[model samples]
Target chain A: MNIQNPEIENNVFDVRGLNLWYGNDQALKNINMQIEKNKITAIIGPSGCGKSTFIKTLNRMIENVPIVRTTGEILYHGNDIFDKSMRVEELRTKVGMVFQKPNPFPKSIFENVVYGPKIHGIKDKKLLMEIAEASLKSAALWDEVKDRLNDNAYGLSGGQQQRLCIARCIAVQPDVILMDEPTSALDPIATLKVEELMDSLKQEYTIAIVTHSMQQAARISDKTAFFLMGDLIEYDKTEAIFSNPRDKRTEDYITGRFG
Target chain B: MSAAKLEFLREGREDTMLETDQTHAFERYKVKIDSGRIERRVRLNNGLKHLFSLSTVFALVVLAILLYRIGVQSAGWLDLQFLTSNLSRFADKAGIYGAILGTVYLMLIVVPVTLILGVSTAIYLEEYAAKGRIQRFIKVNISNLASVPSVIFGLLGLAVFGRMLNLGSSILAGGLTMSLLVLPTVVVASQEAIKAVPGFLREASYGMGADKWTTIRKVVLPVALPGILTGSILAMSRAIGETAPLVVLGIPTLILKIPDSVMDDFTALPIQIYYWTLDTVLTPEYANLAAATIVVLLAVLFILNSVAIIIRNKFQKRF
Candidate 1:
């Protein structure tokens, strides 16, 4: 479904007629949506509604699955990401992602943060230190972990590790950040910290977060898309969608009639 | 009662009977739990613990006895004079200096060649190769190769490195034969270590802009280093103690001069022990010489394994 907003002049990602299948079972069916630049776009749905699969497709991360196949157009900055001329590494460099779990590398905190920059060939020790500092400050984890940058990342608490992961992604300096339930594994207070981080992060990078919590979508998102069984049921401003949903299923889902 | 109400009462009675039957079944289950079966299970668990301990003790006793026997035989004969002297026709004048040098030189070749070939094959199979019939076939064959008789590998090595390459039973041929013998073990172990690396780590790496080669070198290999090193060193130790492959490769048992290079003729510790044990029928002192050689070989293996354990621990702590 194409629910374009007239005010959104610059779209970061425009997914059109996207159909994805794992072997024979279809996971996403003809999905069409636009993610606006410099905004938090939340995808809300029940489990198994293809929210995670959809976001992974934007950066072609879903191709890691050997049997997964997709037929459609996912345009990033007006270029088709699936085209042969577009390199996956280059696309991923511009579009970074954070997973559901706090998957920090088994390395020192500084090493973890600098991994992305290092992969992109930043070899100067002083330059990498600066990048690590900036990214950690942006992720809001520098204050807690500044003294222990050389300590292993696994030594941190779950919340701190997740922030470290975000800092690692930020070090790459990507234009878009896709979060697959970034706060599902966190407590309410940690979740609040992440929500606040997202609010500030949007000023620097466009974000597409796949979350199971409608309250979170309402609390933090500028635009929200509701997916149901691989279909885009409704797409609109978060306030409008929460207050007066156009689709009956979206209203039913939000009101707890059914998932 | 009315007719409909009478029918409903009849259905309720049947439902009550079914419920009573289920209650009886539940009671039987509870009865079974309270029976002596749990006591029997507890007794079995304790008995099995003791039984496993006994098996461990038995193996330890056997090993201790073997070590004591070898130690007793090597006494006075394992002096520094025996270590520094060259091989001789008389048993009292014989030394393992040449054998020691040969074994060290052989390992210098085997260690590097085995690691390079084994780790590369593992990385190619686990990361780069497509998962299909060919990949499965290669994997199965590699595993099978691990179990193939070491003598077969020696024959293959003799045919390829010895005659075909015109190396002619030099230290290179013997070292190459031992490397072939242990290569499958290293490859299989490396593959398992690489495979055990969590998928999420790779996903996290790719989520950044890291390509496959970068991800493997930085993320996967470091995490798998300990397991890879432990497996490889254990396989190398096995190669050091192995005699059949070297024997098949026709490595000498009594070289007088120390091996200076891979192209020079050499005699390893195992080959010396093998010849000495056989010569004990004519000269009974050769048995003590064999025992002394065993002591030295064991020390070498012990040192190699200890170093590997230290390296494994260092890497394991980082992750």
Candidate 2:
């Protein structure tokens, strides 16, 4: 692989020998990779391969679950995120996440978008409205829903609901956005829309996406990381990994061999 | 052709035709017989079911008749004045004013306090408390308390709030006792209401980076409020009808004046009716007064329930 991009040196996330366990059952083992700044990095692996767990650990979201244990060093912009001084809420604000399913609160569409900002103590109505509008625009849902901001979010279509969730995350203005299969629950058309949105969002935010679809990763991501049995199999540019993978297992996974 | 061969063939053809006709006739008769039997059986079964249903109606009618007879016997004494005026020294002139005031006073204190304590306890148990032996024990005790007899609670109130606390025979003492008596019911009901709220709503709030308290405040509580209110109202209705505890707490059978303070002596509606029934003369005036009081109490209960239903409907429509 061509290792000539000096910009890659300023990785937003520099993971080193990350390991995770859920009470003696190892979920992630020895994952090491560098996620580039202002680029979308997609982690693709088969079911039960720790792709989701690895992403969750980035924001310390897994800490909420009892019996979950982790031993690792994850550097965010060269600072260890798991340090004692690091607050989980602060870390979460910096590294936001959208779940696999669209989970908009049973509230108004406007409320759903502004939920994050409100939690952070943003009380100015005008500012919140602007943020809500901008975030929805970024998620490509503003046009369809701008006229009905007060409508219940559950009334939206599945794809619209997913976009609303994305808008909610974006409203917080996080530096990094972590998505765990954001489009897996959507149809092909909705998936394409989300992929396009992700592409646009990468220009402003560093995105780490965990997807089950290899084609989706290849289509939307600038970098691709493949994992197998809780181990990082390969990490490279999207084109190189898909076309000329360095590891046999990575090649096999990309070519539709046994996952 | 030989004559013998032709004769044998003709005979076989004739025999086959006759047998076919006979079989067709027999099949028709059998079908008709089976259908008739099935139809008769179904009719008989339907008739038996009707008879059973009629018997159930008869039983209900008998119960209604008994209720009506008792009501008729008591109606002669029932009158508007008997409900509105205070009880007099003479059995015929006595009214239920003090009892009504006492019941109202007791409920005013019991309902609000019980509601607050019950809803808070439910929220704590359902949302914050960890699953452990202590939580389990508390849960079991709460369920047990709900099933404890009212008379036992009355005794408890007599000992704990009345004597032990030295509250004396006061409205405050009675109200506090009733609060304890009805708390378990309110808590259990509110807990069920809170549990009815979908988990997804909580998850959505959490995903938006809201803390546990904020999520519960903004999402869970609002959604569960209607159910909690309905449960609380039902529990309050039960509290209103309670007489054993008040009797045990030494609520007087009659009082000329309404209670002016929580520390003052009081009488409830049930105690007044009991007092009227105990009068050896069994006069029409006292009996009618008791009936009128019963009607007033029933009316109040109906109004409360209707209000709860209205609130529930309004909330559901909003959602």
Candidate 3:
């Protein structure tokens, strides 16, 4: 369900003047964007652009890298994420992430799904089972994998593994889910399934996806942000960005003139 | 109709692409593979394979010869008495009972202390230490320690464990010395196993709000366990066969009584074999006893390696 924000109310993430550097190389420049709650936002750009970097910044996952320097204010529910008082583990729980590759733990599908809940002190088997079933259903994979819940996750197809990762993310009951090129590794049919999953997922979790496919942004995202050379060039409704971009660079990129 | 027929006949021979004169000699048929070149390559490959086979056969022949020699000497001597009775001044009554018990006691001390200390050091270096010069320095030294002669570790043990701590030549001192000799191997191996865990797994755990220690315990350790166990067993195997460290620690080669406790004096298999081999001048039967002990020591190493292989195969995963 696309968020029909007649008047956008809550800003799930309010990023302002965000700049990040890797060692001596600058990766992201002054960026400002307001990510709306319960909406699917797609970050699109060419190779070497800061789209992935920007998505990582929202959850502070980028800080996992050494020699990374960031200066900015990212307010999640109006609290500065970079503040020293903020606990990374707590932040990550609220802002769950699905990576580009399907990285399910080398474990049973049931275990993979309940990993988050189990770690969060959910010891009841019945509760964990319920959460796992609900998560798999939400990711649109329950019918296909229900009978084989105890099988190793690696035994699943690549598409199913990616869906399992999505199931894993939602099992944590996260408020915002950040996906970094989640379907770049999947085939077209699998890609379509995940795209459909996103439409439903955004009803619960605020999603910000990074993708190289402009058509995907248009197809799935309600809000689209274009990044180029570490700078955020344009941000608007997906329809407008694809139909009538205001900036010359945005037009050039959308029209396939230059990337 | 006659004019159309003439035009068709003329068109068939035109450059519209199938003229006989346009065809080159090389285009007449497909090229053939040079059999001579292939033959030379095959010959070279076969020659090298033969050499490799010979090298392998040489190693197997040597091993077979040694096993046969040991088996011959062990005839009549490797009986139930040898396994159960203690060392004796006489040949027929001499046994490895004391050495076997001592070895078991040594392992009891070595296994827990080495695993706890080595695995913790590995975890600290891999999970907690910054990826910089300090970590590299400690890592390099640990690896270097593994390569240093076991005798050097024995000297260290003699100076520190045997003298400074004043445990004397007791089983405790000998076990500690051997542990020092093998702890580096365990640490290096555990580090490699821990490092082999996927980075994304840790990220997933952390994203689930698990703390670093919790993540390591739940994710890293489980994934790396087979490797850690294999390494530990292999290191312990090395300790089991060690004679130099025991010698430096001065564990007597003639303890006829079983070591009932860690503080008690002990006689290990290698030390018994060493004394037996040296006392062959007294009676040739000592040589046979030494050979019998070798067979038993070989069995211990074999069991350890077998366990290692079993764990590795059981835990081997596609990822």
Candidate 4:
């Protein structure tokens, strides 16, 4: 079910001159990139390189911190998301986020999947059930967990928990999904499963993922962006960036000369 | 090698003699057993010191004796009829029914109101309020209130709700006073329970796009409920046994009928016992009645504590 419509707008998020500061410490500086619609964009960087911070800023989740401040524009479908007219709650619904660790709510698996829809006022049980089944199937967990949906979510394995979290995000029907090192906490087998899920998910939703694994970024992303010291060093096609990067720093990092 | 050995040096023999002399001196000391006996004596002395450290056991024995005395004195009067019948003017006919009714009525009012107010205040402080001087002040004041004597609270209730507001000397006034006296304890306990809920649940709820109040209502409260209920039950038990506050609020000492309204005069079990004990001509019969009331109060407290323990155990199992 590849839903990549090439005629659709290529740039879903157009970030320009974006800068972020946490009190006296500057975390992001002059980050400019174009995130394509219905494509997976992976941000790869070393530790403390602000990849997570940059993705968090896309949905204004970083602004919840008291000392965080941002300058510049993040145009989501040609509208500035940071504009005063923008409702944060609405923006959050449109741009959902999944954390690094698998954090399913301490509830039944069915309840965990349907929590987002219920909060958005989807009261009809049939509709909620349909959405939950669709989401679980999309995350590649329906066949395994469909029969025991009433069981506690914590009873699932680490990979299943991560997939459940993904299902929860998909249930909200968000336009974009932001993942912060979604597979970093999983085993190789679980990581492979998540990578496969990401490949299928990009057909329906734009994804911005921050990962420390360069191999994972190259394997799953259509486009790849490299960040260092809070700066977007290079943004290009994943194969091109890995094989023959234009930037000397990007080449050095990919070739393992220095982080 | 044989030729070299044949030329044994005189210096070597002198060194061997010196080594043999040192060995002989070491053997002389090694044969002695006096130091071994000294070590054994030291160990015995330490063992005797440890054997005398039984003060805790003695203290426990004294406590058991005191409890036995109270239990023995109160055992004869604890009859079923003494609990079911109403208080009579004559000492022989007196029963704890009026006091029991009053206590029940007081609990009916105090339990629900205090639970709601206490849990809400705790949730607000734990979940919604921003960290600042005002929140800190409120927290400190609540801690102080929990320690304030119940008699002082009774005085406050008398002035504020009884005389000035003219609620009159009724069960309503007494219940409200006791509620205020126990509110701080409930809040503190509930706050601790709310705090025990993991931070990840809150983040998970917020991540789901639920509003703050909705998150609290659906996630935080349910997870913290067992702890909150435990605290509320303990607080209610404390409220039930309170005598001074009711005394100050003028809880009637002798009433034949159950309270019909909040404004009606009522006699709690503690007040009834106090009245019987203080009668100028206190008889064995009256003492027996007081003892029976005491036994009933203890039973109620035990039941409430057990309920709290059961709830806590259930929550532990789930977690």
**Best-performing candidate as measured by DockQ:** 1
DockQ of each: 0.85, 0.31, 0.59, 0.35
Q: Per-residue CA lDDT of candidate 3, range B1-319, in tens?
A: 3575567668874543443444554465424456887899999999999999999999999999999999999988999999999988999998898889888999998999899999999999999998999899999999998999988889999999889999999988998898888999999999999999999998888776678998999899999999999999999999999898888788775776777889999988888889899999988899999999999999889999999999999999658
User: What C-alpha RMSD does candidate 3 show over the true interface residues after superposing them?
Assistant: 1.1
Q: Pairs clashing in candidate 2?
A: B77-B288, B78-B288, B87-B95, B88-B94
Residue runs of model 4 more than 4 Å from their true location after superposition = A1-8, A257-259, B1-63, B317-319
**For model 1, how does the per-residue alpha-carbon lDDT over B1-319 read when each residue is reduced to its tens digit?**
4576567677875545565588799988886785488889999999999999999999999989989999999988998988988899899999999998888888898999999999999999999998999999999999999999988988898899888999988988988899988999999999999998998899999999789999999999989888899989999998898888788878875677777888998888989999999999999999999999999999999998998888777776443
Candidate 1 per-residue lDDT, tens place, A1-259, comes to 7876575459989898999999999999999999999999999988899999999999999999999999999888789999999999998989999999999999999999999999899999999999999999999999999999999899998888898999999999999999999999999989999899999999999999999899999999999999999898899999999999999999999998876
State, as a TM-score between 0 and 1, how close model 1 is to the true structure.
Answer: 0.94
lDDT of 3: 0.90
| Clash pairs for candidate 3 | none
Looking at candidate 3, what TM-score does chain B attain?
0.88
Pull out the clashing pairs in model 1. none
Flag regions of model 1 displaced more than 4 Å.
A6-9, B1-23, B32-50, B309-319
The DockQ score of candidate 2 comes to 0.31
Native contacts retained per candidate? 0.78, 0.37, 0.59, 0.34
RMSD in angstroms, all models? Answer: 4.2, 11.0, 7.0, 10.3
Per-residue CA lDDT of model 4 for B226-303, tens digit only, reads 999998999999998988887888766567777788888889978887888777365656766776677788789989
**Residue B271 alpha-carbon offset, candidate 1, angstroms:** 0.7
Worst lDDT run of 10 residues, candidate 2 chain B, spans B280-289
Best-to-worst DockQ order: 1, 3, 4, 2
- What shift in Å separates residue A243 of candidate 4 from its native position after superposition? 2.1
Q: Which 10-residue span in candidate 4 chain A carries the lowest summed lDDT?
A: A1-10
